[model samples]
Target: MAAKPQLPPTTVFLLKTRSSPTDAYEDLFKAPNDAGSRYAPIFVPVLEHRFVDDGLAQIDSLLTRRQITNGRLQSSTGGKYGGMIFTSQRAVEAFKKVVDGRHASTRENATSSWPSLQDVPIYSVGPATTRALRAIKLEPPLQVSGEHTGNGEDLAHYIQEDYAGWKRPPPTATDGTASTDAERPGPKTDAQAAPLLPLLFVVGEQRRDIIPRVLMGDASESGPPHIGVDEIVVYGTGVMPSFAEDFERKLNETLGSAVRWVVVFSPTGCDSMLKALGLLDPETGRAKDLANRPRTDFIATIGPTTRAYLNDTFGFNPDVCADEPSPEGVMRGINHFMAAWTASQ
Candidate 1:
């Protein structure tokens, strides 16, 4: 009769915020009988949400400027908006805080153009973001007109293709003329009435200017086509001052303990975690980061964007990058990693 092979547990690091795939990783590491699972380590979480400061105050200011005078709403820009862009659910929730009137409870938040400007188009980057829009009861419960673009570059290109000309009404209701039989009015098509007002980008503090940079052209360029881009910072992001003492302690519990796997959600978070773990110097950051870490360990990135960062910045191609950018997708990546890792072992 064959005996069960008992082995020391491996240590795994996971850097992600709420709603990430941390749980999936936890479940995968629970069983030690699977091939290569013998080396499956105990998972440790070092990720935490950054302190969201001055978010509600900023939202209130935008709300104040968008005061509903009489029955009509007047915006700070003094014209109709071309459209709206949202890259993160954090931006959506910030707008939710103000629109839903939850200012007293939240610290960080998003911005709003005007309830009357509901006729304008709203674009989102991810499926979670699409769900956030539907949660706000923004009209139809789906993404409305555009395709669900998971990539930021794709989203930027789509916006440029759809709204660059600023022709035709930018679709009144998100669900195609409102779901109810309320007989919604038509979109404003009179070009002379409005000067193709800038689009409102509801974003967080850690945002990348991919959309604006791509659609509006060179940042250094000057003159009329400078493009009207009104950016509203709704949420804040920052890393922990240091990694958790408990995590460090666990790593040192056994002789020569080391991380066997790591899961990162973003490129920023990936570098941030390396810094937190002292793998990269805090002072004079390294040009070739993660050089000191062992080569045998595996890293799993949440999506292609983050994987690109790892490839470009650290010269480290992650062992796996989730194809769909979802919890299930992440699990699939882990499964694939296990299959290959098991074969190698």
Candidate 2:
């Protein structure tokens, strides 16, 4: 009888717990593709986050004072902040707590404490964050946007453009009547700048400053005017104490496969992930030689941020960096790597 070819190794995703039917990665690789490459996706929770009470209190104060709003009308009634920005699901969860806390008595009321803030623009980084924000019950519903941007830099630019127009007064028609100019808001003049409010960013203690830097950084001579951003640290993140052990247990169970992959999501779990893979040298506190390491082991990152972290911190370059931070993007990255590896072999 002819010898049969062995199957591709299992792949593990280092991420937090996600519910089924919604976890994109799980849904994507749930079955084998036409080429017959299948992945048994093992998700290991690497980080735990705790809400900061001080931050939540601040958000509550802003909400109660009616400070976070669309600065359409100037005066004491004008909201302190033009709108809100949410990038992480944890931050959204914290915001949800504050929103719900104030309206605990009126849980049945959909418009409960958020009536004054209904018109405020709530910018979300991606679909996950958007879903999280949408899940929160609020009156008039959350005016969420920027979900399609998929990352901070793009979303920041979107915010810069969208918010500028959002805060601008409707353009008056050349005629006496309000014209189609309402459909296309123009930039606010220098005279109108005084009433503009900065964006309120809800963030974690450990977060990328890309949004703030991109939005509020000094504008180039030809660039759009700088947009203001005010960030509140609403949560702190740390590696779970049991992460290393859990990763080791899961990895050992899958070692039977000749080829395996580890998809890292954040820098937070890089150390534990390397240790679990037996790639970290305890004495030297560095990764071992790739040549000496198992050829079957491969590493992938979800985005450039994590990829850059691995490269800078460990002198390690990932085999794949997903073009987009989506399940389809990850699949494309892995498949491309596999094709290149097979070709090289």
Candidate 3:
């Protein structure tokens, strides 16, 4: 009997789903059921915790006044049988509008908190994420991973492995006491031995807003920021093909040949495209079959709506596939991309 092939480690790919206000709410509510019990869906409620009591009452009044419907209320349980689950690509788009609107409002009140990149290694998810990181004066150590693998968990795993075999700098002796680097030990081989820079991976469209806030938070303190990226890359947006292309060209010029990278744009139905191109193995649900694919890369979306569209159409899970701006899972997917890029290099 032939030996069984080993499965590849997980890599995170951040995805953006474009949707309208109504549709986004519906999706958020229904995501729990749609994704089954394995994944938990979370959303920043529009109403503040303090206002929850009155807010719900007002919402009910609006519903009774014909001001809202099962579709208009953005309610997951508004219709019979809890209304139809929003599975259509178009319906998912309705939700993006709400999320984007909220993001814009929050950005106005946000600030950057990252430290200077003089000694930090950066990881990025897409071009926009890189831009945000650059605004804080940090240089990216590597290129963004272009292919969308689906979420941040995969990205984190990839980074851990890609830089796994790297050798750490020799420990400096101090005052009779020995101190060792806490990040990782020495590299496994000469080929794998390389200096480890600060790693940063940008995972979502909101990275533009999130990066600055993170940088600002980092800079406010005396010591280096607890959370920082050596590089940043974006995964999802929905502007236009021309815009994406132009952005890619500009980024290439900025980074020059110092790093390896690629940009993914308008990746709507990209899984199908990859399958069609033979870049992915449909049978195994993996991209290993796509040997001809680019290695290190950055992806950008023309607009928020486009990202939402791809998410809905592809049924991509934002929790696992896309990075949320919150500290918890924000850069998770981008980290996976960095791992893949490092391995390819």
Candidate 4:
């Protein structure tokens, strides 16, 4: 009888479709030589991105020169501009459209008579978001966390320490610990040059409560956030209806019970998976109630926000999380996960 070829070492479930690298694993597992033993784990995407376009029109309204009057910074409501929070690259791209307006096709349109927000400290969350801010020509001292992956609570600490201008700020560490209450950030009045204006959070409709919880504190009401955020919905997350239909058929046809590794790149993707898998309630959309997920599955998340979601929502600790929220970081995390997994097996 003829000899049969052995299959690859493992199979992985990649919980991304749109932004996930096409050749991620191919590079990781491509055979060095034609005769060398080949080991490449198969990757199947479990989620897809559907960009919402509702709040896009609102950006044009916020970026008007009228928003900036008397050579002084003002809010969309004509109040003092506290500052802006750039948590995602999507928010950065959306803000650019607002400032760039219809003149985006023209290079001269990049610079408008409206004063630059260079004076206001821009607090960015992700490294990609930081790069996006720079791409829009916003200059530094753009305050960012030293670590690439972090939760909104981490962002809150950075704000309290760096933006709030405390006397002795906490160390820029990624361990997810807070400083003593006695060392809490001092308050900044609205009149000072470095005043702490009411922050205008340029966020999506499905945004998490972590930022509001940390910045604005607890609120007694709904509809309007209790936190100090002058919130604006620059975008919303729509769904790719095809992902559910395709994910199941493909998963069954290819992966079956062999599923070992799963990766979550965003909280939205995580929620979508939970809901789709019947582990979450679609009606309530709350994380308090939970259901059992696959015990054999180990999830690797891309950022701390997603990691926090996994912990807070279902009390499930991720197997591994990316140190850098990039394609390379994803590969590194996967390799580390496989190494440990192999050792255990």
Candidate 5:
């Protein structure tokens, strides 16, 4: 019998916080934010969640104890804390600049149109993030409740439903001529000539309503010609949680396995989406202007907590490259991830 191949040792990288390196490292396996310290390190743990649950549980317990004392608890007496913070001073400075610039631009736009922040629909992932957005006076459109950590999937669903009312002209014939009733090709009897399928952007859990009708391939004499879902784009925001396991089962029932998962890391919101469309700098990360950035089809933020979850759960590395300091550098990192992900697919 052939021996089983041994897997390589997984290396976990830690991104420590400037103010609280110790707390950050200690809570490396669970959600980084659970550490109760702003200075907690951002970690990319390379281990499956099942194998590292104990470590994460220990960290969560430590965090709970520390929260009572404001992170002053000791590791020996029921508290386990120790780790490193991975970040560059330059990156931190650049991120601040980006945030400030974005805020200024948003303020300007809001001032010209609506004076109240409540009028705008801000999209956010968690409570902390919603609070942050609210602090900036941006109203969040959607908020996920419970342990069901929200990711890009929710955003995609929102966008699809929001834009469902929009209608566009159908594609012209191959001859580049509009067809009159008599000149039009006979009703499409061949399956290949079926109506164009709706393009589905499946960021996480596949939403049935959002998938294009053509992809479903449901043919019925009693109902309207079913439009099937055509393409699916998968945005990797966090390790796909429990819902991901049954995704294939659900997908098989509708679109089958012909679909592909296009993974893109859109951390900076619409700016990242525009870059993917090849409209913005693929390398420099410079935008022609804020106006040109693609409106976020959906925004999925992998905060410290989500990042830790992904690292601990899938052995996936969050810090795939050196910490990027500039906006352009971040875009480049995103592009690199997209390319690698596409190749793997």
Candidate 6:
């Protein structure tokens, strides 16, 4: 019998900090999707984050004073904000510190440390951030939403609808006196009604304004009522000093196996990432000899935001841009691209 042709080994380098226990990407690619394929995944930490004490203290005050609430339920004593927003895992980590502090201080109490804010809606951008928020140890727990949206712009639109409906009065049951459904009607749309309280957005120093803009921007003639927003920067991000060295070391280690894909999670580390890959030129700061580069070695972005950043800043177009910012979304895009490439070859 003749021997079958051997295929090149495939490896994927994820340029982001890995989540504890298990990262979604690591879990997704742990096993090959194909019987004939082999994939080795490596994580390269790109950014380091630190919590800001001032911002955390402000959140602690708000929770301590019973300031954040759903105005409809606690109208008399509710604070100025109705809910909270989270867009990144780092911000959630910072928020968790405040939560842990409160829990420690009130360990002797019979009730949850977070009493007034338990029922308030807590909006999250995607599954990763939602997971971080969900992991917080609260007594009654958090009411997290927008995990399905997968990005900021989509999550913002979802929040507008959900937050509006949340503020509306609950339905009333009919007494024996009334015979019609209108007599015991549900909450009605109140165009002229007072707007809901602002949402306290806890975010990193570097973040897009899409959420706040969409939720708090001017309401269109036909759109939902404009919700107010307040932002508190609870964390700051910076490229890890050893990113280039670490990334290059990983790439060299995987030299025996063809590094098939480099996934960029954020725009913060693109320059260093590309430089470490030996694809970026030293002077012009652009991709070098694209026509001669390995066709099988590709770059992928988490979503359109990073794609846009690479295109606009470096004039480099990534091979794949995941439609959604999730592990499944990235996998789908890569699979589709590989299928099309194979056909072309």
Per-residue accuracy of model 1 over 1-345 as CA lDDT, tens digit each: 899875556655556444332344455555543345434445444433442447656655644564211111121234334567788766777777776564344426335334433444577776667666666743323233343677667787777666545433332233333122223366443322233456778777777788778767753424324345667777776554454554555445643644366678776556655543455544645423544544545678878888888677755567799887664566567777767756765
Q: What pairs collide in candidate 2?
A: none
Give the number of the best model, judged by lDDT.
6
Worst 10 residues of 3 by lDDT: 79-88
Higher TM-score: candidate 4 or 6? 6
Q: Which candidate leads the pack in TM-score?
A: 6
By summed lDDT, the worst window of 10 consecutive residues in model 5 runs over 67-76
- lDDT, candidate 1, equals 0.57
Decide which is better by lDDT, 3 or 4. 4
- CA lDDT for candidate 3: 0.32
| Of 1 and 6, the candidate ranking higher by lDDT | 6
* TM-score of every model versus the real structure: 0.60, 0.84, 0.22, 0.58, 0.21, 0.87
Off by over 4 Å in 4: 1-12, 20-54, 66-79, 105-115, 137-149, 164-195, 217-228, 249-260, 266-298, 303-333
Q: Name the lDDT value of residue 309 in candidate 2.
A: 87
On a 0 to 1 TM-score scale, where does candidate 6 land against the true structure? Answer: 0.87
- Superposed on all Cα atoms, model 1 deviates from the true structure by an RMSD in Å of 8.5
Question: Which pairs clash (backbone N, Cα, C closer than 3 Å) in model 6?
Answer: none
Alpha carbon deviation, residue 333, candidate 3 (Å): 3.4
After TM-score superposition, the amount by which residue 133's alpha carbon in candidate 5 deviates from its true location, in angstroms, is 2.0
Write candidate 6's Cα lDDT for 195-215 as tens digits: 577889998989889988888
lDDT of 3 by residue, 1-345 (tens): 999874332221222322222323223323433212221122211111111224233323332332221121122223211011111122222222322334455566455211111222223333333333333322332222312223233333334443323333333333322234344577433222212223322223332343334432433325323332322222233333343334334444444333322212344445543343234445665544224655333332333444565456544322123343222223334345455665767
On TM-score, the stronger of 2 and 5 is 2
> What is the lDDT for 295 in model 2?
85
> Tens digits of per-residue lDDT for model 2 on 166-238?
7444433334333343344586443343435788999999888999898888876587667788999999999
Q: Order the candidates by TM-score, highest first — what do you get?
A: 6, 2, 1, 4, 3, 5
Whichever of 2 and 3 has more lDDT, that candidate is 2
In candidate 4, what are the lDDT values of residues 1-345, reduced to their tens digit? 978876554445566543222344355445343323334444445533233455666545444433412111221224344467778766776777765654554447545444345445567875556766666643323333423535566776667555444232222222333224333567522322222346667887767777777777753434223325666777666555665665556456555444355667676556656555455545666543333433444567887778898788766567788886665576667677666765766
> Which ranking of candidates, highest lDDT first?
6, 2, 1, 4, 3, 5
